[model samples]
Target: MTWPVVHISRSLDHDVAAVSSVAGNPANLPAWAAGLSSGIRQEDGRWITDSPMGVVEVAFTGPVELGILDHDVTVPDGSVVRNSFRVVANDQGTEAIFTLFRRDGMSEADFQSDADAVRSDLDRLAVLLDKCLLRTR
Candidate 1:
């Protein structure tokens, strides 16, 4: 069965490169990604963190210069989730879009909750970038 994909986005008052520089870095995940804010550490070339569900391993694959922030999360049960995120230049500022694929067996309510979480995380990211931009100016 094919899962449905949901696109969530947020506009940030910064350039694409600046947004990508922070979002694309695994080390910065805890700073903006609420779900992973507890903490993350690298072990054996994999990023590991403890989620509410359990321990998860994350693998990121994308080009920072191109603003591609795709990553895969391996749950403790061995299931893998793919997250597609990107930073694009908009007329007024930069837009960060995240594509979330609903996992198999996920209920409608669960999917909605997941989307909300992603939105919140993006909001946090925008705030972080805004603060950084202010500091440089």
Candidate 2:
């Protein structure tokens, strides 16, 4: 069965290249993506972070230069959660989009909370990019 999906997005006053450069980098997760992680470190070519659940690995895939920020999160049990993320050009700026899938057995309330958190993370990312606008663009 297909899971319910929601696309969370935020528009930034920066180019797609700029957005991709910062957002696609896992090292910058603590700076903006608080919902996903507080801090991330590279170990053996893998992005490792401690989540509320436990230690997890974030492996970003696809061409980041093309604004494709797709990634997979490996949990403690070794199961992987695939995330569809991207940044697209919007006028002179860019719009970052994160696709969240409602997992099996997930509650409606919990799913909504996840969506809310994603929105907040995107907003934080936009604010961060705004601060570094001159350097990025």
Candidate 3:
């Protein structure tokens, strides 16, 4: 079965390198990816987080310095969800894009809700990165 894919993106004021560095780090998810987890930690070399559904493991699939933020999330049921996220140059700043998939068995309403969550997370990432840039200046 083919899953519907939606690309949710947010334009950030910081440079592409800066956005990728922060967004690609699993340790920083709690601050921006509110919809994904409340907190995250490394357990036995795996990034773990507690979600509304249950405990999940997150792993970055690519290097951050290259603007690739793709990751795989292992849910409580042992299913691994691949998430595509990338940061690209936009003028003097960056555009962070998250590719969300409408998974099997997910209703239309649930899919829309998930898309909204991704939008919110990207917005939060922009805010967080802006704060970091401000502090460095």
Candidate 4:
């Protein structure tokens, strides 16, 4: 199944090309995406992240997998969560739609928390792009 996602961000620099460049590049995800540990793999049209939340695998235009590990204190084992991101140009900035698909038995509260994390990431992205452009000039 698929889930509806929506997010909007505006950049002060107004450099559409630069904004687009950063958004499309999966390698740049860790630079701006909050709670992301590292960008591990970038091959065969996929980007992998060693995320604190889980092992996140993101396709260039497919889907993202967020593994929910089994720890005694929290979530149980054998649970896998999937997500996706759709980026589009909006005025001078960009709008990112994050789609979330989860396994059965998961709670809506978890999904809502995930949405909040995306909001934090978007804020980071704006600062990242601004820093990037400043360094180039």
Q: Where does the lowest 10-residue lDDT sum fall in candidate 2?
A: 128-137
Cα TM-score of candidate 4: 0.60
lDDT, residue 73, candidate 1: 90
Q: In model 4, which runs have C-alpha deviations exceeding 4 angstroms?
A: 1-15, 42-46, 52-56, 62-84, 100-104
Off by over 4 Å in 2: 135-137
Evaluated against the true structure, the overall lDDT of model 1 is: 0.88
Q: For residues 1-137, could you state the per-residue lDDT of candidate 3 as single tens digits?
A: 77899999888888877887788888889999975658999999999998988999999988878899999989999999899999989999888889989988999999999899899888888888878778888
> Number of clashes in model 1?
0
Q: Which lDDT tens digits does candidate 1 get at residues 1-137?
A: 67799889998888888888888888889989988999999999889999998999877888877888888999988988888998899976888999988887899999999899999999889888888778887
lDDT of 4 at 91: 68
**TM-score, one value per model:** 0.91, 0.94, 0.94, 0.60
**Cα lDDT, all candidates:** 0.88, 0.88, 0.87, 0.54
Candidate 1: give the clashing pairs. none
Model 3 misplaced regions, further than 4 Å: none
